[model samples]
Target: MRLFAWAALAACICAAPTLAAPQISALGTPAAPTAAASDPQAAAAVRVAMRQETLPPGGSLPEHRQSGERYLYVVAGRLKVSNLVTGEEQVVEAGKMAAEQPGDWHVAVALGAQAATFYVIDRGPADGAATTAANNDGN
Candidate 1:
């Protein structure tokens, strides 16, 4: 019985899908004119950019923020996030999404031993920086 179980486990392991390597790919960036009605003192041009980021276990982005909003879709593994502005923390698993409002500061930590990948859509001023360092308070 033990021998049979070992053989079965070996077969299962061999049949499992292999994890992919960490990588990043930029989709594209589109720009448009922003109306003064929406943002009284905003820049005339606005942009929307998309990209994918992958990280191995224990990888993390230090606390950061952007001039505009960012949306994230987790493709694999789990994302552990801590928001400094709201003092909230949560783990976003695969198949879920997380949104960060304009100028929302936060830290993201990848969870589990397996690798993780997520798609990020950033919308902001045409010339605004994609990400900026923020006060993480030692996170």
Candidate 2:
């Protein structure tokens, strides 16, 4: 009887359905260009770096400039980016991207009550600094 019971249990277990492997799907295609290099040749010579950044609610990055082009993709929450040069401003929401050209002075502020998380891709000269303070003297 024990042997029969053991066999029955094994058979039941073997007949059970197995779980499927996780699915893989593409997120989506890239959107229209938000920013572009002024010179393609110069952009091609830069090094690429990627990092994840987070800013708490109400936090802000003071007016500054990047040494190279910057692509910021918002993963969560929202960010308000103000272009000091063009007097343009926009709110970047989750799953959206924002780009800043080299030497474009801008300030970013975290909006809403949640912390904003994003992925930053920087393309700059191999030996160039990542960022620099912008001339706030109405330049």
Candidate 3:
């Protein structure tokens, strides 16, 4: 009995290293669906992203006007955002936020020579889309 117990203990200890990390899945993967911040589509009626976005070192430009109301929440670093059409600019820090009005033209750049990240929450047209512009998701 003692020998069997010892053998089992040794086997268990040896097996520990072989244990693998589980493959985790969520409601969306940023732009895909798991988390809300990543899913711009959450505000479907307003016209937002259907998923999370990945930015490069320089950052990103507003591909399209958010069409409704939207806030950008910085996740990692700070960003310098410029409204191309209006020539308005602001510095957004980590854990801080910024916004874009409907039909506004904008662009974001990494601050301090470092990369920046943020999640966008877009709200428009009440809970449902009232017009084609607000409902044009992914636009």
- The residue ranges of model 1 lying beyond 4 angstroms of the native Cα positions read 1-44, 129-139
Better of 1 and 3 by TM-score: 1
lDDT of 2 by residue, 1-139 (tens): 2343344334322322332211111121223332223444443444566667789999987787876556667888999887776777779898776777556678889999999887766654656576455657744
Candidate 3 per-residue C-alpha lDDT over 9-104 given as tens digits, one digit per residue, 9 for 90 to 100:
343223232242121211111122222234444322223332234466776655456544455667666777776666777887776656665565
Model 2 / residue 119 / CA error / Å = 1.4
Per-candidate TM equals 0.60, 0.61, 0.51
Clash number for candidate 2: 0
Candidate 2 regions with alpha-carbon error over 4 angstroms: 1-44, 133-139
Q: State candidate 1's TM-score.
A: 0.60
Deviation (Å) of 99 in candidate 3: 0.9
- Runs in model 3 deviating more than 4 A are 1-51, 126-139
- By lDDT, the best candidate is 2
Better of 2 and 3 by lDDT: 2
Q: Which candidate comes out best when scored by TM-score? A: 2
The lowest-lDDT stretch of 10 consecutive residues in candidate 2 is: 20-29
Order the candidate numbers by lDDT, best to worst: 2, 1, 3
Candidate 1 lDDT over residue span 1-139, tens digit each = 2343344334322322332211221112222333422453443344556667888898987778776656667778998866677766778898766666445577788999977787766655567674544665633
Q: Order the candidates by TM-score, highest first.
A: 2, 1, 3
